[model samples]
Target: MIEVRDLTKRYGAERAVDRISFTVAPGEVLGFLGPNGAGKSTTMKVITGYLPPTEGTVLVDGLDVRRDALEIRRRIGYLPEHTPLYPDMPVSEYLAFVAAMRGIDASARASRTEAVVTRCGLADVLPKRIETLSKGYRQRVGLAQALIHDPEILVLDEPTTGLDPNQIVEIRELIRAIGREKTVILSTHILPEVQASCDRVLIIHRGRIVADGTPDDLQSRFSGLRRLSFGVRGPADRVAEVLSARTDLRIADVSDLDGETLFQLESDADTDARPLLFRLAVEEGWELTELHRDRANLEDVFRSLTSA
Candidate 1:
């Protein structure tokens, strides 16, 4: 539902977001990842119409973000890192105010406010002033304000920041539920958050698009080596010797314990040595007790692509 082409944002001589391009399909949840000063928030700002790009174009449902700024805003709900909130207003009152700002009519305001309150779990704190609530409640209030408009797209920058573990899981589940019906672009420092909440991963570094794909896709693409751990009831030297006959893999570590030997093998990413080892055990009268493979995960891919 969104498209960005060669988008760049600059402040004086430094480019916060270098020319980068990507698209988000309708009902897709995209995770925007980056290290400090990697332009993740800058890109979100440009997409949400909070900041204009220095070059290139952003289209929301085919409408140009520059020329149709107001229309695009109408379609997007934004929760910035530092939430814009009124400390004095009660949660219920605050939500109503934001609903009105989104152009909800007076007759519909109460119902709209009630829906967001229920969805955001603000019932108990409805009468409490925003300043009196805990940081987690404050975040809920911020999210309530964002959803009060019921926009088709949600742009959340570090939505789980400052939230406790339970709150983080709650927000992650909430985002996933929302993504089922609307497009979402989530930016956060937490890698597991991206894994649990986003369908696709997009990594930015040094103001450039470093990686973009489904989690599994990126992991497979960047997984340079595959390592396997094996346990067999046999002599360690003989086991290593038998396994070393293959030129595709090298046994990195071996040790014997309780009449069983453990072997660590490293091979090319595309190679799978399990079948060979299983057949070898059968033919050589060796009892195989355990076999495991260590695969590269999202963090590894992120580090490989974005780390210096």
Candidate 2:
């Protein structure tokens, strides 16, 4: 539903977004990840028609963002990092005003306002002024304003920035539910938020996109090697002797606790040891208590991609 090709944005001599490219399909939620000053917000601004790219093109549902800004705006709901709100307006009144700005007719304003208020859980705050609401309620009001038009695509930047744990969970669940039928591009520094809410992720660094894939795929690609841990009830020397026969696996660490021995193995070679380990334990009369493989996670991937 969205495509960006070699998009670049510059301020004076510095390039904020350096020729980055990616795509988002319908019903897909893509997480945009980067550290501070990594051009995440710059890219979002270019895509949402808030700023024009210095080079390349951004397309929403096949409409060029630069050439068809109005049409693209009609289809996209943008919630910037700093949500612009009328502090003096009541929640319902503020949403109604935004709906009207989005071109809702006078007759349909009330229903449209009600729908977004319900969806964003702002019903309780309807009568309260935005300035009087809590941080969570204020965030909800921001989201309600964004969805007042029911846009096909949602571009949310740090949608849960200042909320409590409960409010964060609520917003995450709400975004996940909305993503079931629409395209979403979510930008955040919170890695776990991506794992919990996004179907895929794009990692940006130094003004360019460095990695793009599902979280599991990026983890596997960066892990490169596998590590395994095992615990057995046996003499440490005997356990070492038994494992020493397998030249394919590298014995990384070994320790003993009471009568039980723990083995840590690292191998670049792809070897399945379930059958061999089980049979060897049985033949040696050792009680094999635990065996497991450890793989890289999103944190590892992020560090590998972003570190200089």
Candidate 3:
């Protein structure tokens, strides 16, 4: 539903986004992740027609963003990091105003406003002025306006920022539900948020995409080596000797703890050494107690990609 081709954004001599290309399919929720100044927001701005790219092109549902800015905006519901809202307007009144701006007819404004109010959980705060609402309610109001027009795509930046845990979870659930029908590009630095709500992840760094794939895929790609940990009750020297004789396993660490020998094994390939280890222990009269493989997670992958 969205395609960005070799997109770049520059300010004076510095490039905020450099030759980045990616596509989002319909009904896909893409998590855009990056450290501060990694160009995540800059990319989103270009995609939503808020900022024009210095080079390359962006297409939304086959329409060029530059030439069809108005049409693209009509199909996109965007909640920027700093949500633009009329502080003095009541929640319902604000949504109605947004509906008008989106070109919704007067006859359909009330029902549209009510639908967004219900979807974003703004019923109790309908009569309250935006300025009088809490941060969570204010966020709800921002989301309500974004959805009041019922657009086909949603570009949300930091949608859960400043909300309490409960409010964050509520907003996450709402976004997940919305993703069931519309294409969503969620820009945030929260790793767990992506794991909890996004289908795929794009990690940007230094104005370029450093990683792109499902969270599990990226984890596997950059996980480097696998580590096998085991605890066996035996003579530490004898156990070490047997493990060292194997050409497949590279012993990373070995220590004697209590009455057992703990071994940390490493291998470049994704080989399962547990079965071999059990067989060796039985033949050597060693009592095997604990055996497991330690796999890399999303956080590990993120740190490896972004770390200097």
Candidate 4:
């Protein structure tokens, strides 16, 4: 579990991570999302003690990250966005060095290192130097080093950033497997990553958290402002008046496209207004081609929160 309270980080005159607070429970995969310059990395660094917070506390499983920095570092695995690896070192040699640094004993290092290599799919490249591997393999090596210590919490910054489509899917699946027992806080710009791998989302914009909830929760809350898109074959100019006259339906806008009428509408009635819209279309003898509700998605929420 992780807890952050009134977390603030400042650099000179600018506040990169403004006062913010949130909690993550064990076994929970929380997505940390934001646009460029949104303070996501700053917050992660503060939590990991890589950068000290100007004003606040971060607790990992009841141990203050600052006060118990060494212990906290032992209990958590951090993979920064840009992984620093010795290019000349072979995969095994680099991982062995990391295991030794984590204080793994000589009696246990080989088995532990082999487990991580298997878990991160680094078997084929164990003998290859880091510089000879592709970006995906290098990323896997970074992840292997992070897990080489067998930490309980994972703070990953853009774990899937430079991976190809297949590599992304593999990493996502790997993260899901890891989430079965460990708490994971994944920071990324990929919206689908949240939908695919996270149980909850923390959306930060302008150095503050603007939203936090499950994907469905955020979508439903913002979807109250709905739009029903449709096409009609009748005169476009009359489309607005025809729908507006209905006491139950609220027409947002109507436009003509290639001689076909388009309606963006909402309903105030207790029931869905689609049935009423169709009956009215039939009565007026206008051809009805399409009608579907437009529900809000994560992308919509991201745009609405981040856009000026």
Candidate 5:
């Protein structure tokens, strides 16, 4: 559980994060999305106690991030965009070092290290130095260190960066698996990753939250325009006349191809033109071959929100 209230972060006079507020419930995976220089990483740093807020407050499980920085860090496992790691240390040795640094008891260190090693698929690379591992494995080592202490919250920034498609899928599944138990705030620009692994999305632009919701919720909310595409067997003039009579529907394009008339209709905002079109076709005795509505996807929503 995490809460951010009117949080703002500044460097000198430049406000990297401005008055944004949101909450992440337990077991939820929140995707933090933004273009470059949008302050996503700044917000995460404030939440994880790596950086202090210029204004507002952040609370983790009811503890204030400013006053309880150490306590909050104990509950949070953070993997920054540029993961800090000891490249010279072996995977197992690195994990053990992190566990000890997190104040894990001497007795629990061995088991905890092994648990994270297996959880993050680091077993095969345990004896190898971190520098010798592949990009994907290096990322796994970063995640393993983050989870070595078994924190309640995981703050991951670009956890899948630089990995190939297969490795990206593996990391996405791992993050999804972790989200089953702990609250996760995943910061990345990849819209599909958010769609595939995150439960909800928060889009930040110019230091402010531009959009917030589930993938479908956002698609519905910001999908101001809707397109209806259909094909019918009928007189093109009569079809155009019938559709033209409806002021709510804007006929974008109409064409006749291979004796079939195709129509593309646009509405200023989301509207059910299907019912009216269907009724008109039925009344005109037109044979409807196909009908469908095109809705916006997550990327469309992102561009619409973050674009200039």
Candidate 6:
């Protein structure tokens, strides 16, 4: 577990991380979200003991980050946004080197390297040079290096930044699997990734904590703001009248689209106006074409909290 108490970090006269406090329970996967220069990376560095806090304290497993910096580093695995990889080195050699650097004994270094290679799915590219691999493979290599020592907590920055959709899903599932037993703090701009992989979300803005909760919990804050749109081959006036009669749905907009009338309706997040609209279309003999739903997601919550 990790605890940050009024932690502050500054660069010269500018404050990178303002007074912020939070706790990460054991076995929790926390998603860290923020815009550029929002103190996310700074806080992560302080927690990992890569940077000293200007004020307050960070405790990892009851050990002070400032006092036990080396010991804390041993307990945490960090993959920065830009992975420090030697392009000329082969994947196998790089992993082995990292294991040794992490203080794994000569007897255990090979097995440690093997375990991470398997866990990170690097079997095929072990012999290839780091520069020869694609972005996704390089990321896998970075992750494998981070896991070489089997640290208790994992801190990943922009883990899936350049991956394709399929690769993203693969990495997301891999992170989910790792989160089952190890505490993970993932920092990325991919909101959907957080929704899919993280147990809870922590949003920081302007060097402070703005929002913290499960994806659903944050989305609930914007309930009743969801929009449902429909395209019907019927009179717009009649459709509006019928839908307006229902108190549960508010007709936000009515427009004439290509060959049909588009009706935009707003309703609570818990309410489903689709069923009743389908019934009305059937009873009124209206031909329904498009039925699309738009609801508040993690991105919405992030924008609302972080935007200036």
Please give each candidate's TM-score.
0.82, 0.81, 0.80, 0.80, 0.81, 0.87
Candidate with top TM-score is 6
Compared with the true structure, the alpha-carbon lDDT of candidate 1 equals 0.87
lDDT of 2 by residue, 176-236 (tens): 9889978899898888888889899999998999999997788778755566788899877
lDDT (CA) per prediction: 0.87, 0.85, 0.87, 0.86, 0.88, 0.88
* Model 1 Cα lDDT, one tens digit per residue, 1-308: 89999999999999999999999999999999888789999999999998988999899999998899999999999999967689999988888778878898899888888888898889999999999998788888888888887888999999998889988888888888888988999998788888888889899999999999987778778867677888999777777888888898788888778998888887877878889878988898888998888644577778887778
Name the regions of candidate 1 deviating beyond 4 angstroms: 226-267, 273-296
The residue pairs that clash in candidate 4, if any, are: none
Lowest summed lDDT across 10 adjacent residues in model 4 is found at: 266-275
Better of 4 and 5 by lDDT: 5
- Residue 13 lDDT (model 1): 99
Q: For every model in order, what is the number of clashing pairs?
A: 0, 0, 0, 0, 0, 0
For residues 1-308, could you state the per-residue lDDT of candidate 5 as single tens digits? 79999999999999999999999999999999999789999999999999989999999999998899999999999999967688899988888878878999999988898888889988898999988888888988989888988999999998987889999999999999999998899999988888888899999999999998997788878866677887899888888888888888878888888989999887765567788778878888999987888644677688988898
Candidate 6 has its poorest 10 consecutive residues by lDDT at: 219-228
Q: For model 5, which pairs clash?
A: none
Q: Which pairs of residues have clashing backbones in candidate 2?
A: none
TM-score of 4: 0.80
Give residue 269's error in model 6 in angstroms: 4.0
Model 4: per-residue lDDT, tens digit, 165-194? 998898999999998888999999998898
